[model samples]
Target chain A: MFSIASSELIQIFRNRLVLITSLIIPAAVSAFFVRQHETYADLGSLGYIAAIVLFTVAAFGLYATAVTTLASRRQNLFLKRLRSTAEGDAGILAGLLLPVVVLTVVQVTAILTALAVVAGAPANVALLVVAVLATVAMMIGLALATAGLTNSPEHAQVTTLPVTLGVIAMASWVGITGTENLAWLKRLLPGGAATELTMNAWNGGVAVTDSLLLLAPTLGWVVVAVALATRLFRWEPRR
Target chain B: MSTTPVIEVERLNLTYGDFHAVKDLSFEVRPGELYALLGTNGAGKTSTLEVVEGHRRPTSGTVRVFGHSPDDRRAVRPRMGVMLQESGFSPDLTVRESVGLIGRLTRRTDDVDRVLDVVDLTGRAGRKVSQLSGGEKRRLDFATAVYGTPELLFLDEPTTGLDIQSRDAVWATVDRLRENGATIVLTTHYLEEAQQRADRIGLMHQGTLHREGTVSELTHTLPGVIRFALATPVPPLPLHAVVDADGKVVVESFELQKDLHLLLGWAQDHAVELRDLAAGPTRLDDVFRAINS
Candidate 1:
């Protein structure tokens, strides 16, 4: 499993698209947020903006990446071939997901660092770590769930679009609008937990109540998404 | 004969919704033998192979590889290798990386360089899988399948989309593997490939084993053709089991000598010349078509 994970990491790092999305996108988004912080002169305003940026990366990096990888692996019959080997289902799934998880972690760290340095904002390290972990798990589960509905590699991007768009809209609005009711509703959104967690972290202390609320939805999505993926995931490519 | 069968299937059945992909299939492949699964498209050949490879569990019945159930993949997989119709390497990974990665999965690993050389991909080892031509990619697929030095190998259309030269290269590697005491279960659309490589053939049609035996056994069971062209146009004859066409006559029979003698006497008495006379045995394709139709 470790060897498989290492090889997958190497392959993911070599992919130009994944590299750009993971490294370049977060930096650019952080720059945009820094400019907004200068214009707005409100610390709370930066938290919302950062949450939107983090949400976008979560969707693309974790969810989109997972679905695309699974679909392509199925199309190429990688999943089938893997199953025929000594590796069990868990090993195969973990190996395939390892690279995406690592990329998400790196991207999250880069974005948070940019927010702290460029925006002159202090970060709550412990809360940020929890948010990153939760967001990564949620996105992975969501991607696998989406993979169940995708028939081929071509449909991966399209199948992932609906969830991605929904998360983006809700997470972005909750961050930008700063509405209390929206924050409560964000708890139900796919990336809402990550948004709340990131915001709470930027506030320099863990908001235990808010973090716990986000955890429920985030963990709920994980359970549901993984269950669906395990049930519906086809080993072979569907014609 | 050895008591241990390398692969064994008992009443294996598979279904895709209402479609019966394979039904009541049973066979065994012993070590040092090349077994061919011969079938046309949609004949459940792939499904049968997949069942034995543990990719798909049988809807009914059972499959065992070397005394272990195929469903117990971990116990069986290390001793078996599979070459699927499709290559599964990441487009970004080089040929060397792909082979090396699979090698890590096996309990016994072959030297990547030696395996690549066997497939004649050593020169192109550094090339990305996406950059490889169709045949090169296939060679790479073959290379990876053998990387584990498995005791049993399942080759699903291993030579598909290859040039004649590449096809022969794959054939040679298969021969070497068999010589080294590996059991091979091959599925191919190419009748000639099975005729050349398989020690015995299993003909599958409509999700069932229509026939199973050596090539000679199948041909001997089916009708053989005897065709001859005449030097002069011969009058039509009301001959039994014979086809009289323009200046030629064809007789379908298992007794070649008796049919040839009868044909020669009829031509001579009618003052017709016989030229380009050819008497041959039946071909595998003939038997295949006869059974399938």
Candidate 2:
């Protein structure tokens, strides 16, 4: 597992296009959102802006990375080759996804810290941590589920569009009109509860009951995403 | 030191929807022996190999490697190495890194340079996988398969992209590995490799094991061929033989030596000069051709 992970990191760094694009997308999204937040000129809206930015970073950046990497490995028969070794599916999955998750976490932390310095600290640090964990899990599950439908890395752009647009739209909608008066929508759609949780974490108005209420749907998305991924994931390229 | 077979497949079957790729195939690869599996295209050879490699599940029957199911990867994988027709390496990874990574994933320990040197690829270690020529990539595939001196190795068309010298070098390496008590399973278009090296072979055709045995056993199924031109028509030959359109006597004889001796004596008696005389036992190619025929 460690071998696969180390090799993957080296390969990622060597591919100048992937490395540059992965870095530029997150950094640019962070910069854009941070600059845009200045127009509101209010500290409370900082969390809402931060949530949307992180959602974009996680949804489009990390999700696309995982899906593309997994699909490419499958299509090229790299995964089939690895399956012949001592590398188990769990270990392989963790090895491939952990780096992406760690990098996202680091990038998110940096952005949040910068925002805190410019604005003020998050209202609820505990809630913020929960929201971050829930969102990352949800995104990774969604990525794997989406990857199952992707035939190759080349086809990833078209296949990934629906989920990418869906995540962005959900986060954008949540940002525009806070998660209120839409109970079923929050519980059902992919990124719905995740946005609500993050925004609530930022706004600092969550009671224990409210946190549980937000937690249920986020966990539900994670479960559904994982089940779909396992059911649909293909170790070989589509013929 | 035990003599149990390294691989055993019994009544194996694999189907892809309505298409049956392998059918009731059975073969055993004994310990420390080089076994070659050969077939025409769509002969179910690849399907059989993939089942043994645990890359695909059999539709029916069983495959065991090292006394455990090939799908029981934890036990069988550490001791086995496979060189697929395509290495499928990431374009950006360096050769050394790819080798090291596979070795690590298979949980094998080795001196990387030593393994690279085995394939004569130590100098190309720093090159990216994409930068390496096709032949070099093939060598990298071989290097990794033989990296830790795996107990059982599968080489599928292992020398396809190789030049003559590299092919010789690879065969030499395989020779060395066999000497080290490694069990080898080879698949190749080069029948001579099987003829010269395989301790035993399994020939497949159209999803069935067409023939399986020692080289001589397979070739003996067909008759040795003898061809010669006669300077002049002589008395009836002492053996059964037919003349071709060019007036060349062609004899397909199972008892080649005796018939040849009889023919030579008749030629001596008749003072008939035998021209363009050639005699040889059946080759693996002949056996393969017979299957196709």
Candidate 3:
């Protein structure tokens, strides 16, 4: 798993396209919005801004990267080549996702640290951490599901359109607007619960029961997406 | 060399829904010999190979590698290497990285640099796969397959994109590996490569093993021919001879040596010059051609 992850990190992080999509745009967007503190009347706006930044990383960084990387590997016969090796199928998938997962963790840490320095730390820090971990699992699962639909690396950009827009747009909506009439929308969409949890983390610490309630919807998405991925994932290139 | 075969396939049959891809095929690759599996398109060779490689399950029959089923990949794959028609390397990885990845995955303990050296890719080690030319990529494929000097190696069109020099280098390496007691199972379009290298050959047509033997053993099944043009009007030979429209005499004989000696004596007695006299055993291609018929 480490060998596969190390090789994948070098190949993925080296590409200029991935660098811009996965890191630069997300960081830049987060920094720009984060500097606009006067626009927020409450200090809790810090976590909301941080949520937007992390949203881009999950969508483009982990999810899109996973889909394209897996699809490209399959198209080029690398997956088939690996199948002939001593690595099992589950080990291969874990290795493929490990680098992206690590990268997501690092980038999220950076965002949270910045929010800490600016807003003096979120009140419900434990809940915020759980949301980040849950979102990571969700993104990885969704990526595998999208990869099943992707024909090639080139096809990944288009195939990932629905997930990218849904995750990022809902994140942006929850970060910037009121939830008065859109209450159910927060639990219905894929990343909605996590976005709400992150955005509200600075308000106060939540009860353990409430945290689980907030996590259930996203957790459900992870299960369904992973189940679909296992069934749909192709070891060979699409015909 | 050991007497036991390294790979044994017994009455293997593979079917794809309504299509029968292989029919009761069977062959063995003995230890330390280069065995070539030659066939025409859709001849069941690829299907057979996939089953042996554990990529597909045979509809019936059994394939054993080192006395274990190929489906027990963890037990079998570590001891074997396969170079398919395409290696399917990730273009984003450098040559050295790609070699290392395959080596580690194959449980090879050899240093990555040494494997690259074997394929003459040491100079291009730092270059990404995308930067390498077509022939260079083929060499990379060869490098990965031979990473651990695997006990059993499968080469499917190994030299397809290689140049003459590179082809010679690959064959040289294969010779060295065979000398070290590695068993090689090859599938290629180049008949001469098999003719020169294989200790035994399995020829498949449609969905069955049409013939299997050493090159000479297979070639001897057909009659050899002697062709010559007369300087003047052609005379009948001591043996049964046929003349073509171009006025050239042709003799087909199972006993080519004795018949050719008699024909030489006949020409000498008549003082007739035998122009363009050519006599040799039938080639592997001829045996292959007979498959379609």
Q: Which candidate is the best by lDDT?
A: 3
lDDT of 3 by residue, B1-293 (tens): 57888999999999988999999998898888899999999999999999999888899999998889987868888899888787688888999999899888988678898889899999999999999999999899888889989999999989998999999999999988888989999999999999999999999998899999999999999999899986677566688988877769888889999999999999999898988999988889888888766
Model 2's alpha-carbon lDDT is 0.84
- In candidate 3, which residue ranges exceed 4 Å CA deviation? A37-46, A173-185
The most accurate candidate by TM-score is 2
lDDT of 3: 0.85
> Could you tell me which residue pairs clash in candidate 3?
none
User: What is the descending lDDT order?
Assistant: 3, 2, 1
Q: What order do candidates take by DockQ, descending? A: 2, 3, 1
RMSD after CA superposition, every candidate = 3.1, 1.9, 2.4
lDDT of 2 by residue, A124-206 (tens): 87788888888899889988998999998888878778877887788777666766668678546877777777777776767
Provide the lowest-lDDT 10-residue window in model 2 chain B: B230-239
Question: lDDT tens digits, residues B1-293, model 1?
Answer: 46688888999889889988998999888778899998877889888987788877799997888899887867888888888787877787888988887776755567999999999999999998889998898888888788867888889889889999998888888887778888899988888888877889999989988899988887899767877666564576425545455656677878877777887788778877666778778888888788746
- How would you encode candidate 2's per-residue C-alpha lDDT over B86-129 as one tens digit per residue? 77787778888888888788887888888888888889999888
DockQ per model, Cα: 0.63, 0.73, 0.71
Stretches of candidate 2 above 4 Å error? Answer: A40-44, B230-238
What is the DockQ score of candidate 1, to 2 decimals? 0.63
The sequence of per-residue lDDT tens digits that candidate 1 reaches over residues A1-239 is: 77678877787778887667555665576567666775543634666666766777787777777787788778777677667678888888998888777777777677767777877664667766777788778788888888989987578768988988888776666665554775556677677767776777776555567566667888888998889988987777666
**Model 1 TM-score?**
0.89
TM-score computed on alpha carbons, candidate 3: 0.93
How far in Å is the alpha carbon of A175 misplaced in model 1? 3.2
